[model samples]
Target: MTSSFHFRPMVLMASSLALLAGCTSSPRTPAPVEDRTTMGRSSTPTATPAAEAPKPLPGSENAGKPGYYTVQRGDTLTRIGLDNGQGWRDLARWNNLTNPDLIEVGQVLRVSPPGGAVETSGVVVRPIASSGPSSSVTTQDNAGNKEPTKESASKPNANANAQAMQFIWPSQGKLISKFDANNKGIEIAGKKGDPVLAAESGKVAYVGESLRGYGKLILIKHNGYLTAYGHNDKFSVKEDQLVTKGQKIAEMGNTDADAYKLKFEIRDTAGKALNPVTLLPQR
Candidate 1:
């Protein structure tokens, strides 16, 4: 019986060692974990940029005010007078400039007459008959002959009576383009050497290629308006020369244009470009 009891204890010890050996032979594996350091940041969107504003034009602050003009680069007294609807001589007299050609950039000049009243050299009168006289009592001279009326005695100034002026077509051709926000004038498509006529009676203000995009340009200064003829292959008029309505001023060509054309524009005294079609007569 003692031997059986000792054998029982030895069997229990063997079983305990076998369990420890099995535990040491194999270890449990841990589960895998995800990396979330930049999880939300990777899915985030970026902000969009804002749009830029348009740049203001030069001398825009003085727009709509006709009494003054700010001299820009490449400006001359004649060009300024043309833009302001006055003669160059008149501009010289108004500003009392000793040298009209000497003008600096950003210099302010008086565009309008002093006290806002234009000075005249001679008197203008209406005919007595046209004045609604009740009787036809003609004034006889000492020679017993009919005396000339005051209307015949004095001639009216052309520049003073320009509000009633009219305009005509500058060229005969198909209108390829029209005036818009991007285009300052209308384009008339024509063959090279086609006649470009003056839209109204005026004195030529500028004649040259100085103006960009307007090749061989001619700027005519009417009393209250200014007309432009651009992209001409040949010029028929010179600067400071007087031109009547329907007079040939230039020849259509593809100077700055892609094709043979005449670009015509009409501007006010303030140098603001206007749609020429509005002022031209209907075909």
Candidate 2:
């Protein structure tokens, strides 16, 4: 009886094990990994692009160009130029202004480095060329810098006179008023509307009328000297202008007298008045 009972229990255990084996998990292929290459790149920092700096557009304000000027009410090319320390003609030429008088309001004007002013530190006292007036205006300097006017006037082919500072005449006329300790410089007499030529070549230092006795005045800084021409009926040149020899600087007239007469003076940059008679020729 005991042997039969043990055999029946063992047989029942084997049947349970056979059922468990049928439910065992099956081997898998990991769902055949999807090809993400068709889904595009990883959109991460390593795969993303970087931003670039913006470039300046053409005609922009900071396009590495020069400064510009605008016209306002009651602004003329000559008047604006004088106020800004520039030459009147240069302003017109820079803007391609058909006529200097035609500069209208809201017009834009260009400026260069050597616009119309004398902006240097040194002053040069040059010499009159012996060859003549035409060949005397040598743009070339001897050492590529400049020779003293005294030296350049004496040398014929030594070199160009490229020195930054040089003195020239303010106006051409009969020097009526002579330089005096009591007075400043000599006076040049002209008609009510005579054209006053430049005494030498230099830049216009000032313009317009501002004095107790003087009617209208223009100041030019040449070499080491500053020349002043007063009592002008009209001025052809403006402040801070680079002028040439024998060029018409102004229309001579009597702003303070019954007739036309120019009260002229020469002063160093330090404001010490000079006697122009000593500097002018005896005619």
Candidate 3:
């Protein structure tokens, strides 16, 4: 009976150790796979778009050409004539415009005469005389008597004649502003209804408020030069009329200005503004 009990205990112990070894030797089940389909996607960032360039102004293609002008917005026939040193009537005839007021933006205009030829019908061409003091030229007559010749007394000097152009003050007032790139002219302080005289003798090319920032403006054409009178209360002269130096052309007022004043400017035929102080007489 004792041998049988010992044999049974040894069998039970061996069976327990065999079961533990089998449990350790068996492979463990893999973990459940994670579901990545519901997670947010990661991607590279998108690039930003560039800004667009500004468009060019109308009629810019014909710019910088001599003897030709590209009509811009707010352009008038009279203003164009003054800028090109041509009369408004002449411009009307050259362009064959029935209505001088109707001009389109981007339209190309002939600023100079076609083929460099000017129409001289019914126009008188007088020779310019020298600016020097006049002197009598004497010639011996047939009877040994000295006589002054009337045919060839004056000599032509174009440069001297051009330099002899004189200008006067448009108003008798204190100067409020000087000419500059931004101003384009000088400002003269005056009372309302003050007389605005012409700075030089010329025909009236424009007399209206069509141009912006120049209310009741008057543009006078002086040969190859142009004078502008702005901010007027009343006009005393008409277009195409001849005006004398120091003659009243308009009345000064606060039109397009901060105070009652006269805005005067001088320009060349190419639309370049010149200093009025240099042209006008000293105060």
Q: Give me candidate 1's TM-score against the actual structure.
A: 0.56
Runs off by more than 4 Å, candidate 1: 1-66, 73-102, 113-163
RMSD of 2: 19.1
Candidate 2 lDDT, 1-283, residue by residue in tens: 9899999989999998887776675454467788786567665546467788766432245333445656677776644544443445555666676877776555566643235443431334465345543423434475687543432344344323323223345555565666666676677776777777666677775687645456787766555455667788888887666787578787877886666888776565334676766666554
Candidate 1, pairs of clashing residues: none
What range of 10 consecutive residues in model 3 has the weakest lDDT sum?
118-127
In the range 131-224, model 1's lDDT, one tens digit per residue, is 3443334678888999645433333345543444588899989999999988878999999999999988778867877556788888887756
Candidate 2 similarity to native, TM-score? 0.43
- Local accuracy by lDDT, each model: 0.76, 0.61, 0.78
lDDT of 1 at 76: 76
Candidate 3 has a TM-score of 0.64
Rank order (by lDDT, best first): 3, 1, 2
lDDT score for residue 128 of model 3: 41
Clashes of 2: 20
Superior candidate under TM-score, 1 versus 3? 3
TM-score sort, best first: 3, 1, 2
